[model samples]
Target: MRANLCSLTFLLALTLQITYTTSKHLAERPSFLNPCDYNGANFDKCFADNFQLLFSHWHDGVPGLKSLGSLDPLSIKRIKIQQDSGATLNIVAELENMLAYNASKAIVKKATLDKSNFEVDATLELPALYAEGNYKVKGTVLGLNINGAGKCNLEAARIRLNFHLATKLRDEGDLTFSDIVSLKAKILEIGDFHIDVQNLFGGQRDLEATANDLFNQNWRELFGILSPTLEQTLELVLKDRFTKIYAYVPATYFISNMPRASEFYG
Candidate 1:
């Protein structure tokens, strides 16, 4: 009788062990048995990958600005970008005193990035010029930002931008010049800016000569002499005061294929 009782006890213990092991295995497995488990880790991974793919294509697929028609000489090119990954970028393209008459070209000279965000440094090259009114360099941003939270699966954040120009003095004379000249006032938003010309020609002969040449329709000659100076000035100003002039402008349009969700899991 005692032997039979011992056999029964062993059977009970084995049954309990099997039950415990099965329960633990189920717990370790993914809790995605139901369709409502869309909020699981698998979903997060899928969403993140899709977002990155979309952004990469947008950045590299868009045609360069050169495809666009002639840009105005008085305007500077500006680019701003934001990402859902908490990254922000800003880029400015300066004409570098390129002549309006020449077939000017702008290129991305250098790019800096912090993990996910990137900023491009650009320079404009123009043929020699003898005349100058106001020259412009065109800049644009071709990127997208996506933010997901709560019930909304995606949101485009804001990006702000502000641009300024400064010219070096060329002659030794007190000449009043305006830096913040408004060209197409309506084209830019409320905060666009221009150079502040206050007695710019007080003590520079070369600058004065170049300015005169620019105004006299000798744009080709002016470009050769002034382009270097303009490039230097732009580098200095951007390094010293870019943060102050920086603005956060929002994305203009959405470029994502992801479906908008009414709610997200944390």
Candidate 2:
């Protein structure tokens, strides 16, 4: 489950645009404000209940969840850069945009918890995630900076992921969630895109048109190069957060049957 949550966070970095709002259908009083009581008579039920509550809050984006808004289009203040040159030739590029994610659309396919292990699988289909902004660049072809502004939209058909988590009871009667046991995802279909940047590098219409044309032609390559790096970064961030949340969970909540620990499968 840690991997799953982290994957969602990573997706948010690429997309989350608005704060999560409570849903009438899923809304309810929180089952537990903190970790479950490991010593509760029904420790298994208590553990499952707590997991469900957290999952719902994450899916709906309640107040206390770690909200990473840096990549959100609205939160992006500005992106300014001054580059000198490059090999073969000199080039420059400056761009900006706003991004957002729809928590309401995040769908959980499966969630399972046993003893000290947890797992979750889910998918999300973003109708449209876009950035409405401008850009400026120079060097290489135009030999001079050209200024332009436009919009970029990404329509993702589906995003599917699976995550597994392991936990151990501590000497202090608390539980500690191990690092993600496994994290896997398949992001499919970014089928549509639009880019229109006007040429501002003097009256060289052909040069500007050429630059825009080249960019449009190779945007896919650019996305391909960047996606993997972003995914790894997100995985690390989620792992850290998961460990912290589980650190404070009382061990009793997971091992109420400590005497029979040898018989527990997870």
Candidate 3:
């Protein structure tokens, strides 16, 4: 949920690009983030709603925050994956242009926030998520030997992710806490990826054709075995970018005035 919305903030940092067109600037101290208070009635829904609103307006970068730029062609210096199968399957890929489409169309269906703890759990759905990238890859998977670089395209038709992510909070007291975002996301499902990777085996016509056939035929199993590596890879990407974006904003900016523990009991 939040993961889909994550494009614009840690959430944004993931997608990392913008300009806030609205007169209400995100830099307006207390911004839209304040109402996300923990003690506020229906605050969880409040947070979710706000996330969706902002996602819809993602093209407009937050005021007073440095633009992290667009999510399209998200760059990846490299991804190295090693899986234990009958024979080790290892893949190392470097992508300069990776397109993640329709990120702004993400819907945060539900969000539960613990502002004080800097935690959020949300369910996010995106109708269509399609990506294509130019890749240089070196890897071996299944019984096939794959070594080469080529073009890769992926169609993750519909994406549904349950995000359990936390921010490292710095307390400003009085229930206010700084965003201090350090993101670690747990993705429940990324949906099915209909994909194609070309030019493997250095164009060994026989092996290349066979590998392509195998990829199309055994994609499900491959993804199952590779999901962990994929998740870890995404986590690294998000964490690095999230930190870079948040670095410019003062920690206090994300502070939310939440009710103290005593309020609920007293």
Candidate 4:
């Protein structure tokens, strides 16, 4: 059970890593992604709309962003998650052809960029994402011990995310520049979650059916215990992802039309 739990954690981390990893050099922003003008009267609204558009094309590789064209139906080597030394739950699983969906439907509540101090804040609400994959999972889930294999699907619903990005000032010879320094992300709310893993107890058809029922019936309680750790993992994963992206893509591409740092400081 411990082994399986570790494997699930590893696989989940791998899945998230692959989803956001990007590296390429584009001298300018892609035309499809229209940049927002900070000087505009409706800068916040413009920025929010632009942010939503980015997610709409998230899974698909935008030529201007990265060339890693496809990011769906990923083959997971292994996955494991253990809670409290397996006292609560332990799951070690493997998934083939995994795909995560519904990011395009995300809604941006508000987004603001404060150039004076080089800070960015955004609030977003995601209704749900259905993740489906062919899986083999073993351990305790919903207070039942079971061995399961076959198709599995899960849904995480009513999640809200808040993000803040900070920048640092850099002095290079005669020119001063603002560089992305850090990112903080938080999960504000999670209303519900559903997990379905088929074929539990290995070859026992009746037990399998009953286990699935229990999973559906007791998801809320299970999720409540799991949400805290999940949120921390998500925040760390997202911070790493955006930081890497900013590393590869120059700041000029993001705010080229805005007033120059020279003009503001001079």
How many clashing pairs does model 4 include?
A: 9
lDDT of 4 at 51: 64
Which predicted model would earn the best lDDT? Answer: 4
Which regions in candidate 1 have their CA more than 4 angstroms from the true location? 1-71, 75-104, 109-118, 123-130, 133-229, 235-266
Tell me each candidate's TM-score. Answer: 0.19, 0.43, 0.70, 0.71
Candidate 1 backbone clash number: 40
Predicted candidate 2 versus true structure: per-residue lDDT over 1-266, tens digit per residue: 00111111122232334343332122223445444454566544545445544444444334333333322223332343333323212334455544434423434444445534434343334445444455565554323345544443333334444444554433432222222455544444455444545654554678656766765565554444334543554354345444444443333433333433333433
lDDT agreement with native, every candidate: 0.22, 0.42, 0.56, 0.62
Encode model 4's per-residue lDDT on 1-266: one tens digit a residue: 22223322433443433344333444456665666565767767876776666466554644554423323332233344445435556555566556667756778899887878778798989898788877776677656777767888888899898888896544443333446687777778877777777766766878877887787777665565555556655555456545545554445444436655566666
Candidate 1 lDDT by residue in tens digits, 1-266 = 00111110000000011111112111221122122122344543333333232223322222222212232221223211111111111112222222222212222222221112112222222222222322222221122111111110111112121223331111112221111111110111112111211112553555534433333443333233333334343343333222211111001111122212211111
TM-score winner between candidates 2 and 4: 4
User: Scored by Cα lDDT, where does model 2 land?
Assistant: 0.42
Query: Predicted candidate 4: what Cα RMSD to the true structure?
Result: 5.6
Question: Which ten-residue region of model 4 has the weakest summed lDDT?
Answer: 1-10
TM-score of 3: 0.70
